[model samples]
Target: MSASPGAYRAPGAGLRALQLLGIVWTLPNTLVGCVLGVAGLAAGAHMHLRVRDLAIVFHRWPWGPGGALTLGNVILHTGDTLDSACMTYAHRAGHGEEAPIVLADHERAHVYQYMVLGPLFLPLYLLCGGVSVRNRFERAADRYACEGRSWWPW
Candidate 1:
């Protein structure tokens, strides 16, 4: 018997396989994130798994300048809360809480990039101009957060 149209359904086998592949491909970066997460936890950060996003997030990470950083599927956030809302602490000109972009979505785009690029993501990200808006990856992630599509820089 089938459930209602809006009922939750498990992912198909092929989709699960692809998800597993992504997890494996991004393991190295995830490991680094895990290490940092552990350190954050030791320093009093709170951790939780966001099932819908399939990400581990550490809130109040005790580092960085009041924003979020994504490594693999892990998000290290430097605030008491993390959510799909425009980040007021991002310090971008003319963008505030009412901005269309969501911080969590932007970080999720980075997760997708790490899944596809694997270990190459960090070096390539640095070479592409690091955290600045000039970076293609940053631009793509911002676009993804604002438009809800097209996360890939290329």
Candidate 2:
């Protein structure tokens, strides 16, 4: 079952076990995100735990495209705040204006993707077309952000 956008469901014991497995599976990518996040921290970024997503977020990251990037369970946000607000870039004229895609929701989808793909997510993301609307991963993430469901690329 899928939760509403920005809503979080508490995990039961079985789900917790699965979450643990995902954490281990995505450890490599998580480590890479951590290294970058720590560097950002050293550069004056602030760190916060997003309890709902079970992810680490670095706000005011000194370097980035002025939006956000998700690597494993870590999200590096260029802005001072990361919330359920729709991202400027994700907004388009005459498209889903009533229910714009939320930035945190989108990145959370990437976190889920990382949990499933682990080390392969980055390579496959590039192979599918990096950071473009045409990319399957991006599409899936957008869908998840907009509809709050179906984050899987397949």
> Candidate 1: TM-score?
0.83
> Using alpha carbons, what is the TM-score of model 2?
0.89
Evaluated at residue 148, the lDDT of candidate 1 is 70
lDDT of 1 at 12: 88
lDDT of candidate 1 at residue 15, scale 0 to 100: 75
Give per-residue CA lDDT, model 1, range 32-62, as digits (tens).
9989998999888999987545579999899
Superposed on all Cα atoms, the candidates' RMSDs to the truth, in angstroms, are 5.0, 2.4
lDDT of each: 0.77, 0.83
Model 1 whole-model lDDT (C-alpha atoms)? 0.77
Report the lDDT tens digits of candidate 2 across residue range 1-154: 6667778878899989988888789989988888999999888999999977768999999996688899889998998776757643234434334456678888988998999889999999999989876688987888888788889999
Model 2 misplaced regions, further than 4 Å: 1-3, 87-98
